[model samples]
Target: MADELVKAGILSAPEEIDKYYLHGSGHFIGLYTHDVGEDPDNLLQKDMMFTLEPGLYFPEEGIGIRIEDTLLVTEDGCEVLTADIPKTVVEIEAFMQS
Candidate 1:
């Protein structure tokens, strides 16, 4: 992710990547607030309920966006638990315009 940001000129260097994004891509959300799942290799497994969170913080540019999606891993794929809420840009704008 940092490499792509550098190539696109969104970030100066990989070392500064933490400055713009300050959140984990995902974390376990079962058993307690943060389960810390028993995955030693840090690999996501099946039946794991967690949050896939992505964030971008460019405070100097006045841009900050963070997305959170709670998911339940399954054999077929993952199910978004937050799907009940409208999160698309078009949906949000239309709702706001109403």
Candidate 2:
């Protein structure tokens, strides 16, 4: 995903990567924001809940963005519980105007 972001010109330098992920990528979202969970090395299983949060931060530009979604692991893939939220720039702008 970081590679894609860089390719799209959303990120300027590879050095910015560390600033974006100063904390871990994401964590379990049950009971608490950082719920108890096994190590990420464990295989994902059905019904497991987690937060998929990717961020980009540019302190020099005073810009920071983070998109987060709760996911439910399934047999084949995962389901985004926060699908209704507006993620794209157009969608977010439209939502704000409404």
Candidate 3:
């Protein structure tokens, strides 16, 4: 993730990556915004519910992007529960204009 951002010129040094880290990629979301039971180091399994939120904070430039989606682990891949949300810039702009 950091590598991709760096390649795009959004970030400079690799060490600067920590500035955008959100203290963990994501967390379980159930009864609360941040549910419990999932371990960061453990492998994912079927039926598990969690979030995939990668955020970048370029405070100096007043730019930040954090996109989150609830996911359900499956046999093949995963299902996005928030798929209906307009996440892309163009989508967001269109939605907002409506």
What CA root-mean-square deviation does each model show from the true structure? Answer: 3.0, 2.4, 1.9
Top TM-score prediction, candidate number: 3
Q: Estimate every model's Cα lDDT from 0 to 1.
A: 0.83, 0.82, 0.85
TM-score of each: 0.68, 0.80, 0.82
Model 2 agreement with the true structure over 1-75: per-residue lDDT tens digits: 667668888668655567565566679867777897767789888999999887767777888878889999999
Better of 2 and 3 by TM-score: 3
> Who wins the lDDT comparison?
3
- Candidate 1: clashing pairs of residues: none
lDDT of 1 by residue, 1-98 (tens): 78998999988888878998887787789788777877747766678898888888998999888778899988888999998766789988888898
- Which segments of candidate 2 are over 4 A away from where they belong? 5-16
User: By TM-score, is 1 or 3 better?
Assistant: 3
- After superposition on all CA atoms, how large is the RMSD of candidate 2? 2.4
Listed per model in order, the count of residue pairs whose N, CA or C atoms clash below 3 Å is 0, 0, 0
User: Of the pair 1 and 3, which is ahead by lDDT?
Assistant: 3
Give the Cα error of residue 11 in candidate 2, in Å. 6.2
- Evaluated against the true structure, the overall lDDT of model 3 is 0.85
